[model samples]
Target: MQQMQVYARVITQLIASEDHTVQDLNSAISAVLRLNNINKSESPQHLKRVAHYSRLIATNCADTYSLSEEWIEHLYLFAPLHDIGKVFLPEKLLTKPGPLSPQEFERMKTHTLKGRDIIDHMIDSFGYKDHLHYTGMLRNIVTHHHETIDGKGYPYGLKGDEIPLEARIVAVADILDAMLTKRVYKEAWSMDKTLKELQKLSGSKLEPEFIGILASHKQELMNIRTASAE
Candidate 1:
């Protein structure tokens, strides 16, 4: 109990401090989720994998598009929170095995806004301004990660570059992880199959440039996934 209190205090301090690093935020987020019993997998490493793969995808995109290393790092840290809104979802809805009814799907869609709200609340409560850009990027990731290149995505149908670059990178990362993982409703897709699906969706469901970056760093991303699973 004492240790948990210390952890909570440290997390609160980091969130409130202006000098907090992305690494600090990442650790704090993980600790908070664990304390809340939010992640209950055998390995419970999905968030770490998502963070690693998101950063790799972002790095590849950053290099291909001539973005800064700082921006890429910000995407790495913020991508994990894209699903933070799931915390607002009922546990039954989140862990359901069957296909969602139309009503349930509608409820599920609220996660995007819920996630954005959580982060926004955190920013307001913590009063940290030094990482404003990071916070903005995280907000984009949470709110727009569902958006597609062809304007068919949810929350908003932002097309092409209208969506934030960080969100585009996260889209690739999130889909890749979801495709590769075995969920309650579906078996894991093979890497080859997943890559082919991504290719098929390149222009319509995903940004072509980001997909190109993902293709270029396929092995590196796979390596990160493999390492995280081990």
Candidate 2:
């Protein structure tokens, strides 16, 4: 309990201090999540790729999305935290070799809500409840990234434009990386296959407008994916 208090104090000071750069804050957050056993079956580069992809998509659609540079940077930084809640999940379920049973799948779906609860605690502890673009954006990303455009997602059935834009963007970034990166359960998908699958998800599972924008930067995205593997 005393150690947790000290760690929390460090994180609060780190993020609350304007003297620290976004990169510094991002590193602090990453370190905390890693310490907690955040799981990513892909290489450590998974977060980097997702952040890069999310930034590219957000920048490309800046006009449509009304994104400012500062906001875009924050989005990139927070994008990687979307799955931070997975750390709370049982290691056995997370590393299970085969498909999960329906019960296990339901339990898995709780990660979104779990992520939100985690962020809520952090905001309360850090006293950032009033910071909309800061804590609020992160909360939205944690809770809504898995929601679908067609209202079929878990935790909440948010449909169409109802899902927060930041979450929607991270959703695309997260899915792309998950598909393209090799995991123990499956081989890495070819870029062509990944793109094809993403295209199919447009308007149903993802925002269709952003899908085209993301595809236009195929080469850059691929570069981010490969660079991480190195």
Write one digit per residue (lDDT tens) for candidate 1, span 128-179: 5464566678779889999888998888889989998888878887888888
- Residue 55, candidate 2: Cα error in Å is 0.4
The superposed Cα distance between candidate 1 and the true structure at residue 152, in angstroms, equals 1.8
TM-score of each: 0.84, 0.89
RMSD vs true structure, all candidates: 4.3, 2.5
Q: Which ten-residue region of model 1 has the weakest summed lDDT?
A: 1-10
| CA shift of 129, model 2, Å | 2.2
Which parts of model 2 are misplaced by more than 4 Å? 1-14, 18-26, 40-43, 131-133
Using TM-score as the measure, the top candidate is 2
Candidate 2 lands at a TM-score of 0.89
Q: What lDDT score belongs to each candidate, Candidate 1 first?
A: 0.72, 0.78
